[model samples]
Target chain A: MSQRPYNFAAGPAVLPEDVLRQVAAEMLDWHGSGMSVMEMSHRGKEFISIADTAQRDLRELLRVPDNFRTLFMQGGGLGENAFVPLNLSRGGKVDVVLTGSWSRKSAGEARRYADVHVAADAADSGRIPEHWDLRPDAAYVHVCTNETIDGLEFHELPVVPNDVPLVIDCSSHVLSRPIDWSRVGLAFAGAQKNLGPAGLTLVFVRDDLLGHALDICPAAFNYETVAKADSMFNTPPTFAIYVAGLVFQWLKRFEYQGLKGLAAIEQRNIDKAKLLYGAIDASSLYVNRVHPSCRSRMNVPFFLKDERLNDGFLAEAKAAGLLQLKGHKSVGGMRASIYNAMSMEGVQALVAFLKDFEARHG
Target chain B: MSQRPYNFAAGPAVLPEDVLRQVAAEMLDWHGSGMSVMEMSHRGKEFISIADTAQRDLRELLRVPDNFRTLFMQGGGLGENAFVPLNLSRGGKVDVVLTGSWSRKSAGEARRYADVHVAADAADSGRIPEHWDLRPDAAYVHVCTNETIDGLEFHELPVVPNDVPLVIDCSSHVLSRPIDWSRVGLAFAGAQKNLGPAGLTLVFVRDDLLGHALDICPAAFNYETVAKADSMFNTPPTFAIYVAGLVFQWLKRFEYQGLKGLAAIEQRNIDKAKLLYGAIDASSLYVNRVHPSCRSRMNVPFFLKDERLNDGFLAEAKAAGLLQLKGHKSVGGMRASIYNAMSMEGVQALVAFLKDFEARHG
Candidate 1:
């Protein structure tokens, strides 16, 4: 209840306080059952309820049609990069749109399983690519909807060949906005960012794409087997799934400006991004290099005009109770990841810190 | 803690009170960082120390050999059943020794990738198979050391073909005893039981068995790729790994009677099993069906003599704060999973409840 620091960690980022409190209260005993949620059997009736409702809520939230199956899996986004190619690619040509670090990594890992081709690369712009070369007969086209490191995002998905499926790694920005399911054949994200915690990966895949896995696909990692078993083909990450179920419930009740559910959260995210990006654009001392049109709403990476004050800026930010504002080591600067849980108030406080820091050191 | 419930839910079962207390205390901020451990990046120096120390302590406790690489992965036990075949089986013949439910499941899942052979099965004796019929040319031999559902176990591993490696799913009883590294090619366990939580799988594989994954293996599940990147090839289940690390630290400092570390824990486990099994044997109202030699030291499944009284028994058990005593649906009865976190007092409490319930029923 005391003043807590505002966190801006990119991937394993800040979670909603309500979710944390709920977890704490349920740690000793869940729902008067005299056992923690962690202790329940995945197959038991109690846990079955948890799993059933989580899947149902997620389906409703995503407005997923009857043809798509959602699976709660393990391994993070990086794991899915190869997992995606292994299941969808048959050692055939696969087109990859390299938006930033994550998409590039995905293409590199996929090379072991498929003939990978980078249809687009935005390395020069340090942003999401605006143009993509279409490969009509490719197995699938891959994209990272939001890249945590480069601060690039594909607001509008690219049009790919009709024969090719589209795979999106939406790890950093999942649940923050509406996804265009028509443009995506398979989408996967780690749960650490906007969902409950680490360890759980949510995979949304079309029915037709399920059985195309290469002969060597691990049954557990195969989208077909997993979808058939409802993600219970394996002993699931039970506790993480249970927590995520609770989060879906929380999202169902979330409200903002007369809009409820995911829509409300999406609006809040948009507003938060606008406030922070507006401040950065207004300041001569701070600059975000990515094109304004394709900037990530979830992650905003920027640098001070003078790089010498980077250490000082971080130290002062920490002292002011603004935590984990440092950007990735690969890309030096500051990153403010305003996830679903990050309040407008948190962003406001961050903007104030940025201004104060600039006044002191500019 | 005022006589809390005796929790015996298998895996994600019971956690040490000390660990729970420490987690609660650190929920707001870890050390002076003003950020939850969950909020820290896996790449951060703070979390690197946590991940490194956990791996180090676990190695020291288990005395893992230099030739083996320990990787912290995601996906629960069942997921690994497929992941194992994907990484090590290479679609060749896989020999399986089915002691109980878990091994049977493993063999069934492996059939999707390999020409699976039942090397041994113990359904007749309600125990672990005594003699394993290993294939000299088998790609790998799989075993589940502890069967949580059936209360069966293979306390001592078998001598297998030298050319064929042994892969053990030690999910229910890992770290309870010293592992014979010379015989084990790969040992994997889900963290929910003796480790920490669900969603994390600990895989200790010999370096030599690293790179022969099937072309269909999901890149993330490939042991060679995971090892090359030190398990950070993707964003790992960071929070679970951190908690598992804390458990390793606790085990290192543990002492019992003149014994220390794993030796001490094993002795305690043996004593707890003896005490409870003895009570069950002496009582007319309750009975354990497992063969005496293979009865698990961790999970003990027993049935009430009067089948009609099962519901009454469970209701009373919950009322008495002996919780989650219901057996798995596959096998109808009661199961007591006294994992490493369960104390001697907890076992005594459960035993006392059993006696009281029997006396009333009689």
Candidate 2:
């Protein structure tokens, strides 16, 4: 393995080194097209083939139902906060379950286009709320499957009535495991985390939810328009999509333990999260406050019990080739987001560093 | 120079070879930071520095005034069609000067948010209209300075009254020449063409125009929100901005015929456009329909008199390492987009091929 630092940025986070190598190797010319993927017109057959393969591979990996239309789009998760309501809300009531900062933002943005009701509020609980007061008349129910900042995730989705489709902002934990698409009306993810690079947003919308965008929704963001054009409605972030396609290929070929592909990645993620959280729990100098039942398998936010050592811990971690361990300013201390790209070895290194630091500081 | 094919894609177009090489070399480790540019956190000092330097270099290159806040955003030109009105229109009357397809789309999208009036229609005219029906009470006057598909351009912007801000969609020709900022209020470009890549949209909005978004505007696309947050209100496309920053640096270091930077690029663009148009005008087999005075200096669309040879022309050109010469589907012919990245030699090669093909078939 390469000796590069293990980057722990929450999103726009680590990508597999092998994916980066492949991207570098192919930067000058993608395949034999004699043009960089960035240079290819989005409408060209070469790019179309790339787009199709990526969609197909992703569908196969997730076992997405045939009724869902995968739309490659721009405008990260924040953009979709409004887009979901604009497309699905029909200018009616939207029931939002406020799990953390992300879902709070979603409800806030959705209020501009629809009547928003917080079906459940768990922003401070550090765990998923056990029950939601969903309304049958609601246009949709909005949830954030993984809160990148709070380090909380939904291990199982909240049950909504069949008539009221569920919408998820799964930016951080997408592709780490399989999604339960049967209950999902739409799932949107910003590709900066586990998927690939920044700038691309993936939206999987069931066919039934296609054409009801509010007049205020931009055509580029109108789900039906994007679906019809196969996300070429507005250039669709060509380079980002190409890099993401490469990532899907990487995920497809991934093998670990006794499993393969998404199954393998899920197992690895579970192992890495367990190792890091276990170390934090056992250490005197470190702490993680989230409920174990819902603690994120991707983002593991921890703090130094002695808050004064925060800077020293980050400095020491950087010196040891661990990068971006500082926590989000909103919820402070330190965050080590071990996305699908983070290896067990990388996690082990972090655990070792944690123990050594605790021994010295304690 | 590398022996790569001359790419003639319109937007998501050709990028400087040196920039691509730098991107490739720095893919695994960015400036010894031990992380790919893609992996760096947007808030991290490493990426913030990259973003800052890029903004500074772009400001310097364009000589952007202090009153204008340059924002790095997403959702391409099509997205900006709605964003322009949503942010600037204030749900009032919007007067649009329809130059071609892009401006027409802009007008159509603006109508969704504002009471739109076609102040000038030049969609069928091969040149810019000499006059427009000015609406003094309008929120803004919209114009597409260069129509990428129609091969039409405004050598000078229409004289909108001082009170009304003029919004220009300059996606195709931005960065190829200096903007006369004094004649404009806001200038927006999808960075797929002369800038760097797709997914990153550049908006230069005057400070006075900041806080006037419609109530329904998504916060992610709200100009005031974006400006106040310095385009970090949401995760601005980090990788695209990094690449564009490199392109900006490349432009700063550019030299041609004793000219430097933007001046050098402008001169080269002028020369490249001249070479390609000159070739078509001199040929009996191909003809350019747009008026010479208002012809685009970026996209030069031409038609084969004997249309049967279109297939042969494209095939032979591709065989000779000239790529994406086929015109846009909306306008069926051939187009050579000689943006800032296209070298004089590339144009010269295309001209030579043009003559050789005509000599045998004329």
Candidate 3:
């Protein structure tokens, strides 16, 4: 832990240190199987166990309903932006709620497959829209529950007015907190952020939402095809799934402040986010403009009030062992993605750096 | 190498021992970055360098033309079956030369996206089609250069008529031989076979074939969109790409029979095929039924003369550390998939085992 740097890049982000160590130990021989997890056949008993354990543990962690089937998939959130419409839109109209960058991209991509109408927009305020114009005949309503790029999150999910199923892109903040499964018809997240590695995408879809794929949808990406096969329609990202399974195991046994499982992690995330935001609020040289109620508990995109000090702040922070503390180009001051892997100690260290840097520059 | 088994699973198959060792050593941290490659953002400098090095090395190894762009993608061969037609078929007709199980799957998937015409069919016999009635008005001609399950391969590519672009599924034998680029327009290979792992699909497409995708094609799977972004259209399977880059580096530095680069690998593959097949041909107890000219050099599927010895053969092989020797369920006997990472030593040992097993049983 002493030799480690706190990585803060959003999506393709940090994983648990314990998971990495365990993976390293098992790289050459998994459970004495004499083959790396990457070398195992997807259909082989060994890999099937790994994949099954991951699905079971993840289902347990999320408290996903029995009606929902968790499909281990490929293609990131951006891919699902198209996959959502291809599977659910049924070549008809679809409605979207544009909260930030991700929802904007989702709407744009959906238009190619269906007539995507913006049911609600919150681009100007960087908040989840409180109002909505539901299209009763639309196939589904799409919302990016958390914008990885814009540092916005929906702490509370919206209840769709129509019977239209709600598809949520919850890539960044997926496992950080519990999901209200009743409101979600489908939830997709790229594993890199809070799960494990890139290349593996996790899609949780209700069993009823299975078979509405447009003809043009790739069979492997079709929710029904993948679900029926138990996500074995194609060879899954075996290594990523194995690692994600390890993460799930770690989460299940995790203990923090007398809490366990997802609860422990959620509590830690709250503390971590609060500490950083509290420090930011107390500072004169830093700010995060996203509405406080909707500010992401997983990703913290902050801006230097004196923007010229941005580069200096990042470099100084790096020298102090804080790393990848650069903001996305779209919002150019700074961002600190304190994902599940980020510890309370790491947040303390970051807050210390923030205070020290501001005193020097102020 | 002593600790690792001789894995012959048909991919997510065996990888270079050295690559695995290096990966293990760097699993905790990469190049003193204090973050695993899996933990880095795809757009960040470290990952970008890795992505660039891999792309460059692959281009060099394949001698991919300047006009072609190698896109690192997700979704396995099955996904690309749909992706190929969705992008290049342009909602028009496409010609397919069916050789085996894989080509059969491809033609089936393409039907959803285009007017799929079977120009040639070799279903009645396990042989590469010698002739074709190519559709001149078709968007492209599709062929599977290697059939992993059927153990049939095209030693020489079919010459498509009317200058129709040739889309080849080279999944199982991609890096084992040199591809004749002039005869190919788009080549897609799931990385599990000869590359690094599953979940990362490598698609090499000519520039001219880029933007003809129908409106319904998922933007993430769109060739032009991916090419323009240099395979970073979405997160491009960062760890798999990094490991693949290591494989490319290993291939570049590999020396056998005084040959280098793809030539070295080609020679080794040719030797490996000859060694294993020679042993099979000499024995009355074992047989390979494919036409000699079109027998796959990568996947060697052989059968015991007595069907009763199948499980016994597998048990003995496993005891002898010859792992994953069971044949594909589709063609049940025994299969030894000696891809790029399978050594001549491994093949010789397998030959020795075959002889010994037959001597005891015969």
Candidate 4:
């Protein structure tokens, strides 16, 4: 909108402009307190109010059940890969259904704390597998609801064996739609994507999963201690949490015709995904490899039939004011992550760019 | 400052007004890049530039030698309590000097991973101990350069015996002065204090200490992996890093006529500490229990002789716009943390308030 490129980074991605403006206005003095939020102690009244409101608003927004405890954690999604096992695995065998890159990494990290077994792999399906062979008594089953790198996502959470709990790494596609909590025991996401900032991690765990950490688990990272202290066990990331609270407030006010909040965003996301994927599918030069059934609505990783044009395509795209459109290092191509903050105009501009690039290079 | 109270929270504490303003101005789009720093990927060119510049600027500001690797870590001071032992202690006997609350807690956490031995205790000395019984062959000797809650600090780093790495948890006083690297192998601090934000932790470890991590340490947290990858082994707290970079630039431009950079800050801190501590020592009604030799230049904790007036004192202080003056939950009193961002005017105001309160209640 300001004659700059639309960013499509997966995580550590965009935030709403409204939130940014509010943050700017309140930077020097928050509510006439003459102290920035960063200067307040986590235990201080100002920061305490911020933390409490963040948790309460998040709970209301997600419709998180009464039995679930929402925790503000650190150490990104990868850091939690080991922390999740350290707390829940108890050195017991656990099941992981590898949908994409994130799930694979989660299982690998869990191997250090638990006897990990892969229950399913979508590698054969070229998408997130619909089938899951979960162990009945496994300590927990891990899954990545949305894979940022692989552009694959599980449309619906798998029905785990009643004896096992489901822990999800929903970092990329969280808050885009409503989650069915019936099949999940724990849901976690790094806040860089849809929420607000990069440092804060949102962890929603059922209350019963609290106390079973391995002795080796650090006290600061132990779920039981964090939950007991209301996530202030140690100094939580106060500023990041404050920013995330602002994003939640923004979400509460989001509207679209007859829809509002999550419903409104869900409708927009569905429309955006359809438009881009449709454009990609219709083009002879552009191709997306993931199966249609599990194509991610958040991240769309596509490739050109001719790989050599990748450089030129990216260069021209950048010049045309579409930024950060390159794919991940491991997988070479292009990825466009149209998060909640990205508008319909941004996507339309992108679509227009895609058509123009195809016309020139085809 | 704008009729608001002074905030003396040890951490999750105050940041610079200029930096906060810059953050506000660029919150929506960083330098016309059309993306919030939060929206950029860790590996993208835009974010890579940010990461590189921040690291370079910090290294220059601290005069960090090339032999040391600066890692941007998570888990705060407490999380690093676990991470340090897991990465550097490596089941070897680790000698810890109990300076105050932070060192004691670090020792307790290290016990899970290694043979933790307390080499000295200042709980009796009423100060952080100067001499330590550090083991000659210990993996590392740990100290807290500044204890936030106890208002105690080591004015100079202890010179441990040969090959015994000295690890200082400088969480409360990092960048407030020039680090004595000759006697130190590793120095770590949470960024919330004098650095920038709550989620970022800066760890400076000598290169030689990189490879000896415990086998059970999480790969994402392993110092060797992080150091080798330039702290990009995982998705970092991108926004926090950018803000910290801005702070580093601000520090570069800081001047105190004869002093510049950290030297300017150190002098400012010395002056601030003298003002508040002098006021406390001058009044019979107010007392600071810590030994004068090792009083923290950052945190000044003072108690009213009449404990009955504590509540009323806090209430009146709040009315006077002195916020977060409450001490740690473990120690009930008042503490004022004057980081680099807390101006001398703020400290003078607090001193003025203390005098008026003592006079009214004496």
- TM-score for chain A, prediction 2: 0.99
Give me the runs in candidate 2 sitting further than 4 Å from their true place. Answer: none
Error of 3 at B313 (Å): 1.3
lDDT: worst 10-residue window of model 4 chain A: A1-10
Best by DockQ: 2
Cα RMSD over interface residues, candidate 3: 0.9
What are the Cα lDDT values of the candidates? 0.85, 0.92, 0.90, 0.87
Q: Each predicted complex: what DockQ?
A: 0.54, 0.90, 0.83, 0.75
- Per-residue lDDT of B171-216 in model 4, one digit per residue for the tens? 9998888887888898899899889888899999998888988877
RMSD of 2: 0.9
Best by TM-score: 2
| Tens-digit per-residue lDDT, A53-157, candidate 1 | 999998888798888889988777867887788788877988988878888889888998899898888876876656788778998998889998899887887
Which numbered prediction scores highest in lDDT against the true structure? Answer: 2
lDDT of 3 by residue, A1-48 (tens): 456988888878888889999999988899989998989999999999
In candidate 1, stretches whose alpha carbon ends up further than 4 angstroms from where it belongs are A90-93, A127-131, A137-139, A159-164, A211-215, A257-259, B90-93, B111-115, B137-139, B161-164, B211-215, B253-260, B304-306, B356-362
Winner by TM-score between candidate 4 and candidate 3: 3
**Model 2: pairs clashing at backbone N, Cα or C within 3 Å:** B12-B192
lDDT of 2 at A253: 94
Q: Across the candidates, what are chain A's individual TM-scores?
A: 0.97, 0.99, 0.98, 0.98
Query: Which DockQ-derived CAPRI band holds candidate 4?
Result: medium
User: Predictions ranked by DockQ, top down?
Assistant: 2, 3, 4, 1
Error of 1 at B343 (Å): 2.8
lDDT of 1 by residue, B1-362 (tens): 64567788876688776676676667657887766777777877788888999999999999999999999988778778888998888778999988788899899889988999998888758877657787788999998988989888777877685768999999999988889998899999999898887889999999999999886666777899899989887788887887788888788878888898889999999999999999999999999999898899999999998999999998888788787888888998889999988889889988998898888885
Measured over the true interface residues after superposition, the C-alpha RMSD of each candidate is 2.1, 0.6, 0.9, 1.5
What tens digits encode model 4's per-residue C-alpha lDDT throughout A233-336? 87888888989999999888899767989889989999999999999999999999999998989999999899999999999988887888888888889999
